[model samples]
Target chain A: MNPTACILVIGNEILSGRTQDVNVQYIARRLAELGITLAEVRIIPDRRPVIVDTIVAARAAFDHVFTTGGIGPTHDDITAPCVAEAFGLPWVIHPETFRLLEAHFPQGEFNAARQRMATLPQGAVPIPNPVSSAPGFSIGNVHVLAGVPRIMRAMFEELAPSLRHGTPVASQSWHALGLYEGALAAGLTDIQERFPGLDIGSYPFRRPDGRGGVTLVSKGLDPAQVRAAADAVQALIAQLGCTPIEGEPPP
Target chain B: MNPTACILVIGNEILSGRTQDVNVQYIARRLAELGITLAEVRIIPDRRPVIVDTIVAARAAFDHVFTTGGIGPTHDDITAPCVAEAFGLPWVIHPETFRLLEAHFPQGEFNAARQRMATLPQGAVPIPNPVSSAPGFSIGNVHVLAGVPRIMRAMFEELAPSLRHGTPVASQSWHALGLYEGALAAGLTDIQERFPGLDIGSYPFRRPDGRGGVTLVSKGLDPAQVRAAADAVQALIAQLGCTPIEGEPPP
Candidate 1:
C-alpha cells in the first residue's frame, strides 16, 4: 500500500464560503497519480494557534502532511511563522530564498515588502516556485505550499520527482441504469469481503433522462484485485437481472 | 458578537482535488454578515471514524457547529448515522423528515435509493430541504446539511428565520499603500492592545502597479470602539507618512 497522507487547507475565505477550496482536489489527484493515499484533510482558518496545533497533529499522525494557504505576505498569511513556532524553530531569512527573491528584482534593491517572502523557518528546505518567486518550504514530513492552485500545482510538479513512490494506484468502475444501491448492497459487501485490499464505493446518479443508477468503484494498488472486484460487481448486477453496463463512461 | 461557529467540510473528493469546498466560504461569509464569528473549519473524508471524531470534538469546542457533505443517499454518504453514533443517538427515521420525503414520493415508489434519503437519527429535527426531499437535520448544536451548495444554502435559508440573532457585527478598516509588515508591526500591536474587544487583523495586498500594502481590520459590537480604533490606525498611518485610503473599496 502507498503511504498515507493528509491535507490541511487553511483559509477563512474557504470556511466562510467566499472562496471554494480548489487546491485540495488538485492535491488529491496529484497524489493519486504519484501512488500516495490521501487519508485525511482538515480545513482551518489562518489563526496561528489553530494552524500550529493542526499542523503538529497532522505531522505526528500521517506519513506526509501537506498544508495550503496563509503563506503569502498578507496579514492573513501566517502559515510560515506559525509553522516555525509549531516546530519550536526561529523564523529567519534563508540566504538561498533571498537569492531567488533578488533575481526577481534588479540591482538587488530589495523592497522590505518583497523581502518578507524570503523569510523561512530555521532549518527548512525551499520548495521551488516556478510560477512565483515566493517559494514554499518543507519542514520534517510537512510540505507547506501556496494556496493558489496554479502556483501550488507548479510547485508540486517541481517537487514530485524527488519524493519516494510506494505503490501505483489503479481503479475500475462499472455503472448501469435502473439499479438501486440497497439491492446491490449484499453483493457489494460480499465482493468487498472477498477483496479485502480493494476499496469499493457505490455512488448513485440521477440522469437528465430521469433514470438513476449506482456506480461501483473498486480501487487498489493491485490492478488484478480491482479488476476482479469490478468483474464480480458486474456479475452480481447480471444476477440481479439488470442490463449490466460494462463500465462508466470515461470523464 | 452573535455566538461563534465552525464549519466542518467532509469529503475525500475535496482533498483529492476532484471537488472544491464551496460550502465553507459560503457559511463563513454568511455568518460574518449575520454578526456570527466563524472561528474555524475542518475538512475530512467519508471515513466514519474521522467523521464521528470531528463532530464530537467540534460539538464540545464551539458554540454552534455546521457540517457540509456526506448526507446524500449514496452508499458513501454515511454522515448522518456517524453523527448519531458520535452523540450516542439511535439511528431511526425522523417522522417529520419521513413525512417530507413521503410528500415528495408519497408511495415510497420512487425508488429504494430515494427512500434511503429519508433515514435519520432518532430525535433529530428536520432542518427542511427546500431544494430536495432529503432533509438535513440538527441534533443539539450540530447542524448537519448536504454537500450540494445549492441545497445546503437553501436549507440554511429556511433554518435562519428561527435562529437567535445577537449584536450586529461592526468593522473598521484602513488600507496602507506599500507599507511593509515589519515596519507597521509596532504600531499595529499598539492599536490591538488599545482596543481589547476589537478583533484586529492585518491584510496585505499586492497592488496592480506592483506595490504592497496592509489593510488593518477591526471588528467588534461597539461602534464607538470600532471607530476609535480605526481612527487611531488611520492616524498612525498618517504619522508614518503612509497614505491611508479613504473608506473600504470593493474587497
Candidate 2:
C-alpha cells in the first residue's frame, strides 16, 4: 500500500475568502509524483485550539502531515507554538534558524517580532526558505511550510527528498466532443467494474461554442492496467458515436 | 456572533491534483457577503464512508454545511446516496427532480444513469440547478451543490436567501511599497490588540516592478471598528517611512 499524506492549511485569509489557496494543489501534485497518496486537505482558521486539534488528528491518521500558513512573523502567525503544543514539545528558539535570520537582516533591523521566526518546536529540524530568511520546521511526521506560494514551493522541494515514497500512480485520459456524461455513465460503470483496481472518473466540460463533452480518466499504480482501461474507455466513446481524443479537449 | 458554515469538497480530481478548486473561494466569499462565517473547508475524495462521516460531522458543527461535487450522473457520483445514508433516510427518487430531468431530456434519451440524478434522500428539499437539469438536494442544514463552477454558483445564489444570516462583515485594506511584514509586525500586533473586534491580517506581495510590499487588511462586523483599525495600520506604515496606499497595488 502507498503511504498517505494530509495537508492542513492554517489561514484565516483562506476561510475569509481574502485569498485563494494554491498550496494544496502544488503539494498534492508533488506528493503524487513522489508516489505518496494525497489523502485529505483541511483548510482551517488561525485559531490556536483548532490548529492544535487538527494537527493532532492528522498526525495520528496519515503517514505524513503537512501544514501551510501561520508561520510568518506577524501575530496571527501562531502555527509554530501551536504545533509544538500538539506534540507536547516546548516551543524554543532554534540556534541555526536564529543565525540565518540574523545574517539576512540589516544591522539592528531584526526586532523581537522578527526573532519570532527563529522560534520552533523542541527537537524540530529547519526546512530552508530560499525566498526569505524565516525557516519552516519539521517535528515528527509533520512538515510545516510557509503559506506564500513561492516560499511554500521552495520549502516543499527541499524537503521532499527525505520523505518515504511508494509506487507512483499512472493515469490516462480519453475525451470525446459532443458526448454527454449521462449517456456514457452506464458504459463507464461497466468498465470500472471490469477493472476494480483502477479508479475511473468522468467529467463534463462546456466549450465556448456552446458545445459540451465528457472526458474519461483511468488511474492506477499498474501502468498496464491504466493503459488497458484507457483503451476500453476510448472504445466505449467510439461505440457511443463520438471520436475519442487523447488528453483534455480545449475550451 | 455570525452564523457559521463549512464547505465539503468531494472529488478525487482535486485530491489527485488533476483539478484546482474554485468552488471553495466562491462559496466562502458568498457566505461572507451573506454574513455567514465560513469556519472550515475539507477537500476529501468520493469515497462513501469518508463523505458520510464528513457530512455528519460538519452538520453537527456548523449552522450551514455546503458540499460541492459528486452529484453527477456517473458512477463516481455517490454524494446523494451517501448523504441520504448519513441522515438515516432511504434514498428515493425525488418526484420533482425526475419531472425536471424528463422535461429537459429528449424522449427516450433519458437512460437509467440519467434517472440516478433524480435520486435524493427521503424528505429532502431540492435545490434548483439553473445550469443543469439534475438538482442538488438539501437535508437539514446541509446544502449540496454541483462541482462545476457555474452550476455551483447558480445553486448557491438561488439558496442564499433562505439561509440565516448575521451582521455583514466590513473590511478595509492599506498597501505600502517597500514595507516588510517583519518590520511592521509589532505595530500590527498592537493595532490588533486595540481593535479586538476586528480580524487584522498582513500579507506580503511582489510587485511587477520587482518591489516587495505588504497589505494590511482589517475586517469586522462594525464598520467604525474596521475603519479605525485600517487608519491605525496606515499611520503605522507612514511612521515606518512608507506611504500607504488605500487598496491593492496594481499587479
Candidate 3:
C-alpha cells in the first residue's frame, strides 16, 4: 500500500481570519516529496472534544496523521490533552521537554502558562523545535506540530528523516490557449486510459474575450509514465490544431 | 446565541500541495464579516467513506457546515454522493440544474463526466453559481460549494443573503517594539481578564538584531471593547519602558 497520510490543522484563529494558515501547503508539498500521499487535511477549532474526535477519526483512517496549531502557551492551547485523550494516553509533563524549556529561559519562573508547553501524552516522543524551545509530539503514527509556519516547517524537517518513504512523487502539465475542454475530451480520455496510474486533471480557462483553453496535468510516482502521458497529451493537442505550450516539468 | 459555522475543505490536491486551498480563508473571512463565527475548518480527501464520515461528523458538531471541493466534473469529485449517503438522501440530478448546464454548453453531449456535476442529493436546493454554470447545493443546514476559489466565492456570495447573521464583526490591535512575550505576561493576562469576550493573540516578531518584540492583537464584534483592551495593552507595554506603536486597524 502507498503510505497515505492526513493533516489536521487545529485552530479557530485560522478559521476565524484572526490568522492565515500557510502550513497546510508547506506540509502537503513536503509529504508529497517524501513519497507520502497526503490524503486529507482537517482544520478544527481549539475546542478539546472536536480536536479529540478529529484526531481519533483521522488516525484510524490514514496510515500517518499530522496535526498543526493549538500547541502553544495559552488557554486555547489544548491540543496536547485532546490528542492524549484521543489515543488513551496520560497527559503529563515530559521531563526532557521541561529541561529544554528551562534551559532556554532559565532566569524567570516557568509559570503555569509557559509550563503547559511541556505537557505530552504518555509514551509520546518529542519533536525538537529549532526555532522555539517548546517541542512538538508524536504518538504512534500521529505527529502533532505547531501552527506557526516557521515552527511547522522546522518540525517537519526534523521529523522527515525518521518517517518511512515510498516512491518519490513527481508531476507534469501541458497547456493550450485556444482550445476548449470539450474539443480535447476524446483525445485526453485516450491519454488517461493509456496511463491509468497517472492522475490527469484538465482545468479550463476562459479569457476576457470568452476565448477558451484548458491545462492538462499528469501526476504520479512513475517518471517514465508521467513523461509519456504528458507527451501524448501535447501531441494530441497539436493534432487538434492548437500548439501546446508545456508548463514547468514535474520536480 | 451567536450564529456559528465551519468549513470542510475536501481534496487530495490540497493535501498533496498540488493546489492551494484558498476556499478556507475566503469562507472564513466572509463568515466573520457576516457575524458567523467560523468554528473550524477541515480538509479531507476524495475518499467516499472519509467524506461521508466527515460530513456526518461536521454536521453533528456545527450549526451550519459548508464543504468545498469534490463537486466538479471528474472521477475524484465524490463529494455529492458522499454527502447524500451521509444524510441518507437519494442522489440524482435536479432538472432545473440540468437545464441551466445544457443552456451553457448548448450543442454538445452533456456526457457522463459533465453530467456528474449536475448530480446532487434529492430535496437539496441549488445554490446559484454566478461565475460558472455548474450549480452548488444546500441540504438542510449543510451547503456544498465548488472548490475552485473563484467559483466558491461566487457561490458563497449567492448564499450569503439567505444566511442568518448576528452582529457585524470588528477587530483592533496594538504593536510594541523591543519586548518579548515573557516581559509582558502579567499585563497581558490583566488585559485578557478585562476583555473576556475579546480574543487576544500575541505574535512575536524577531528584529534584525536577533531581539524580538510581541504584537498583541485584540479581536471581537464590540469595537468599544476592542479599543479599550487595545489601549490597556499599549499602556501596559509603555510601563515596561518599551516604545509602543499603534498598529493599523483591521481591514
Worst 10 residues of 1 chain A by lDDT: A12-21
User: How high a TM-score does candidate 1 get?
Assistant: 0.81
* lDDT against the true structure, each candidate: 0.77, 0.91, 0.81
Residues A139-177, model 1: lDDT tens digits: 888888988777888888877786766776777777867
DockQ of 2: 0.86
For residues A1-251, write the lDDT of model 3, one tens digit per residue: 57989888887667777666788889888888898988867677767788988888888988899998878776556799999999998899899998888888867767667787898999999999999879998999999898877888999999999988888777878887887665677677778788888877766655668676777888889999999998898898899888888784221
lDDT of 3 by residue, B102-160 (tens): 88885866766777778889999999998878889999889999877788899999999
DockQ of each: 0.40, 0.86, 0.44
The CAPRI category of model 3 is acceptable
Tens-digit lDDT track of model 2 for A81-112? 99999999999989989999999999999899
lDDT of 1 by residue, B1-251 (tens): 37878778877666555455677767776777776777777777788998999899989988888888888655567899898999998888666666666677646454555565677777888888876668888888889888878888998887766665556667777888877555566677678788877766665557567676876776678989999998998898888898888556413
lDDT of 2 by residue, B1-251 (tens): 99999999999999988889999989888888889999999999989999999998999999999999999999999999999989999999888889889989999988899999999999999989888768887899999999999999999988999999988889898997888888999999999999987889988888768888888999999999899899999899999998888975323
After superposition of all CA atoms, the RMSD between model 1 and the true structure is 4.5
Clashes per candidate (backbone, < 3 Å):
16, 0, 4
In candidate 1, stretches whose alpha carbon ends up further than 4 angstroms from where it belongs are A107-109, A175-196, A204-214, A234-251, B99-103, B106-116, B167-251
Residue pairs that clash (backbone atoms under 3 angstroms), model 3: A41-B43, A42-B43, A43-B41, A43-B42
